[model samples]
Target: MPSKSSARLAALTVAAVCSAASAVALTSPAHADSVRIHDIQGSTRISSYAGQKVTDVAGIVTGVRTYGSSRGFWIQDPNPDDNPATSEGIFVFTSSTPKVAVGDSVTVTGTVSEYVPGGASSGNQSVTEITKPTVTTVSTGNAVPAPTVIDAKSVPARYAPAGDTAASGSINGLTLQPSTYALDYYESLEGMNVQVADARVVTATDPYSELWVTVKAHEHRTPSGGTLYGSYDSQNTGRLQIQSLGATADFPKANVGDMLTGTTAGPLDFNQFGGYTLVANQLGTLKSGGLQRETTKKQSRGELAVATYNVENLDPSDKTFDAHAAAIVNNLQSPDIVSLEEIQDNNGATDDGTVAADVTVNKLIDAIVAAGGPKYDWRSINPVNDQDGGEPGGNIRQVFLFNPERVSFVDRAGGDSTTAVGVTKVHGKAQLTASPGRIDPADDAWKSSRKPLAGEFVFRGRTVFVIANHLNSKGGDQGLTAQYQPPVRSSETQRHAQATLVNAFVKSILDVQKNADVIALGDMNDFEFSDTAKILEGHGELWSAIKSLPKSERYTYDYQGNQQVLDQILISPSIRRSCKFEYDSVHVNSEFNDQISDHDPQVLRFRP
Candidate 1:
């Protein structure tokens, strides 16, 4: 299981820029020239003067940063250029502490380089930066240029232009169309000071001292006050990541639906995470939104309540144990069965030949019981040490918690990490040969990934098959704001194979008994609208339950402000034919600042 590298590589990158700067040093222009900022940043994504040195690039210091790995100052020309397709400012990358301050007009002589935030391999757009600078202050107390306003009407409705097919759908070769595409408009203002007034918070402030807001107020607003990321086609163009140039301690915390009152002005920067981010020099006041966590009602005696939650690589040593227990007890209403993802090894990430998760599972069960929940029993096979991918040594896997009073686990032993589970017919009923067994564990699809765990359960004398899965994540995929239009999903092929395996397993149970109740649930790690989901539902063997929610309420995970789905609960034909099921993508941790897990829990109440 891999994680998203967007935020991990998001912060203002300096080392890679310095590395790229040296690589292009040998390609200096034959003759040095005095070029305007607009001349340096051409009409395309890549700068026309890249790898060439410029003399006396004149501009006023709009913002300066002496902290962080990227210590530099943003400079903008007071006399603005007429063409909207070219930027009037650029970032002067000073290796150490910068000497310049705001309102100081400086002439810098430096090499114009295109620094791709997460490197070229990440498929991120290159940022035009003036690296290895020699700065000279022309005047003190000079007037900084007025900030450009970015609002609902300013950004284009369209996200980006189609890249040339010859270049493999890369939009870098295309000319900037600021009026027609949002990515082009943002590129036209790179490193220039801009502002958004009274922006609405679409994502809660993260521990990285960053948050996200939407300039387009009413664009795909969800009930929880976050913008919905419905599809790849409709990427909300107005969503911009906000990070302050101020101290991290002084940064304000806000939740979804909160407002940053007044104006937040800053220099537009292209980063690895969310593409165009505003490094705010002057931040706005934060106003509370009074957002609260949701609670689901208890299941009726006839209804079997089931839930899936990713505890975010949880171990016995984590501090969020009580909070997580509360969420399962109070918010989730203590479901009869729950599929818990990311339960780490016995010693957490120590990785000393340990594979058991008894300590990790027992602690959560104890906490649940202490929080007025049931004395739930659990079952799961320990993954082979370091074989499953996750936090290096933190061998995480899915564990099932069931209340013995309500349901009984079928104990047909011989389940292990590498053994594949198969379906057998018993008097016209479907049963697993080995309960709590891994599904197709020997296949390459489970290589360095968590294998789906299948278990047999009997509720009210009726057999049910539950497959808990934490599939391969979207780690190697290109981002939405990548230089290539629609970006590359390199991670999808492995996930597609994984989905096909699980779908075939579900089909096996149905082939024996068509009405077998099969419930596949957990962090699928792919969207409901994605090909992974489609493959998991192969030939109508299964149907994803998340689609039952309205398009606006379909998300269970929020990343860089766009709420989308990465967890799901899908059912077999018997369950779907009943048409008496209720699904809830409960909003708890995703919208709140104090969260135990990054993903929200999902609950399904149905009669089996």
Candidate 2:
């Protein structure tokens, strides 16, 4: 039906119709006026009775929305088959009556009348004597489910920081604010996981005051007042609060890199920063995994750092680090920890041209160790054995390289291997094939299972967590667009999964170390603004370090007619100190060697 004001216009239309009919009678019988309505369907029965009045019309209330404070509402049977869903059904001039909510099954009765085609009423053909008006409930409707409280740990591995949930890691600097507030929104959650992502928390004044925390979740009320919840967990949780207990027990004590987990009881209210109003309950402490023990000591005072690169299938025939090892060994651009992607391995055979063929991945490590320039080390390797590459066999590309000189490794694990990490449930293909997951290019089957690799690194002054990833390649035998689009081929789908796993892993890290300095680096296949990059940058917890640099140096990889910044070096805000981070696009790979690998090695230079 038309809105309340629209209904009044309908009345005016009827009056005009009557005037036109009177004029027609005075003129000639052949020139009489008439009203026309499109698709009367259920109202067709009344069309036959030409001038008869329709006191009551009935059908399901498919759509409804209240307008103008609480004046009146527009109700319609969105069903295409039912033609009685006209804009002029029964105009309820509810200037004094209560307003109506959407989805209310109502029976409206009024004096029926037709509107003249153009001279009088234009859209609707009705004038009813609103009687027997009543609204009932929809039948056989699905019940709304209760809101599912999510733990920070429940987020996917790709999103979590390295060693998130580990008991030993710590967050050093924490500054809270007072004049903070929350925002009200339901869709497109991009900055809800961490507090610093949206608003900066100034130093706390009362000392006992709780720091405002936010959560992300979707909330909706059904026709029957039943509430439905969706995964708004991305960036919607508004500002809530948490209190301090003792040394390591206080919430503020949680380092800049510590992850905190909780559920939203309702929308966040800034007034309740340190308390548990919007929060349903506290999950536990957020910690990057325990520190790893260093087998070697620090030789150079160079600032300990981690960097990611897309070596473009570093699987060379010569299979020795000596080819591009100079970039990794040279102190001017060498990184303490390096996260690499597209690293291919031999089929455990001695031929067929593989990078690890002559000198396995282990040999590269030995060479770096033998040279002993700055003295580096490594962590666990998921390797090609861990992937499902189908008939071709799982020649998996991975993330595993570190510096033992400045950092120590206490322990390591992969997949959703620990209680504090991993996904509890994975929606089946049917749930995602045609849904929102489809809009996302990364939503593929095989890729979801491959997962990302994470590790814990300890520096003398600070413990930095590292998350290394090499998401699915944007281009395959198919093309770049297919990397994230659906109807996903196994290969393309796996790459999408790689992107997803990385997103979840980072989210997990934020869960444990809200403000901890985390470094997420690898070959993400796409540009910095692509969906994959947006997922990590959505929450301000991590920023692409290169983005802070000059635009000319922003790019990390190049291709035919296109030069994109595919590889990324992201870091937590707190880590901005102790380092003036920069990426050197050393043309080593593209130099005289006719390309050391497909990708130019990105050199991250960080000086204390």
The list of candidate 2 runs beyond 4 A from truth reads 1-302, 312-320, 331-333, 346-359, 370-372, 383-394, 412-450, 476-497, 576-580, 591-593, 605-608
Worst lDDT 10-window in candidate 1: 19-28
Model 1, span 289-357: residue lDDT tens: 889899998999988888999999999889988899999999999998999999999888797988899
lDDT scores for all predictions?
Answer: 0.88, 0.36
Best by TM-score: 1
Per-prediction tally of clashes: 0, 67
Best by lDDT: 1
Q: Estimate each model's TM-score.
A: 0.97, 0.41
Candidate 2 per-residue C-alpha lDDT over 216-256 given as tens digits, one digit per residue, 9 for 90 to 100:
22112111111111111221223234332123234432211
Candidate 1: TM-score? 0.97
